[model samples]
Target: MEFTAEIDIMPLDALLDPQGKAVSGSMKNLGLSEITNVRIGKHITLKVKAKDKSEAEAKVDEACKKLLANQIMEKYSFSLKELVA
Candidate 1:
């Protein structure tokens, strides 16, 4: 079976995001003061070959923990879907 994983990695809410703050400040300069507390995160999409949905989920979780996300500062969430062709 083939599966597709859609992952999102973001800084922990307890931590400050300098880039997000900078963008939030810029929003006012652009006369978009309504947009505040801007946050930036990363989205990743990948395809995997697995024996089943559970296998695919485990693989994606392992990938995020081992390589994709920094568990100390960032948190990750992913959704998996089977690929039909």
Candidate 2:
């Protein structure tokens, strides 16, 4: 079976995000003051081949823990969808 993993990686709430703050400041300069406390993150999409949903999920989680996300500074979450055909 083939699965699609959609992952989101973000800095922990306790951490400061300079890029997001920069963007937020720019937004205010552009007259979008209502938008504040912006935090930037990463989104990743990948396809995994496995025998079943559980196997695919495990693989995706392992990938996230081992390489995709930094456990110390960032947290990651993912959702898997089975691909048809």
List the candidates' TM-scores in order: 0.94, 0.95
Candidate 2, residue 72: Cα displacement in angstroms equals 0.5
Global lDDT of model 2: 0.96
Best by TM-score: 2
RMSD of 1: 0.9
Summing lDDT over every window of 10 consecutive residues in candidate 1, give the lowest-scoring window: 32-41
Tens digit of per-residue lDDT, candidate 1, span 1-85: 9999999999999999999999999999999999998889999999999999999999999999999999999999999989998
Q: Scored by CA lDDT, what does every candidate get? A: 0.96, 0.96
Candidate 2 per-residue lDDT, tens place, 1-85, comes to 9999999999999999999999999997899999999999999999999999999999999999999999999999999999999
Model 2, runs deviating above 4 Å: none
Q: What is the lDDT of residue 26 in candidate 1?
A: 99
* Candidate 1 wrong stretches, greater than 4 Å: none
Q: Report how far residue 85 has shifted in candidate 1, in Å.
A: 1.3
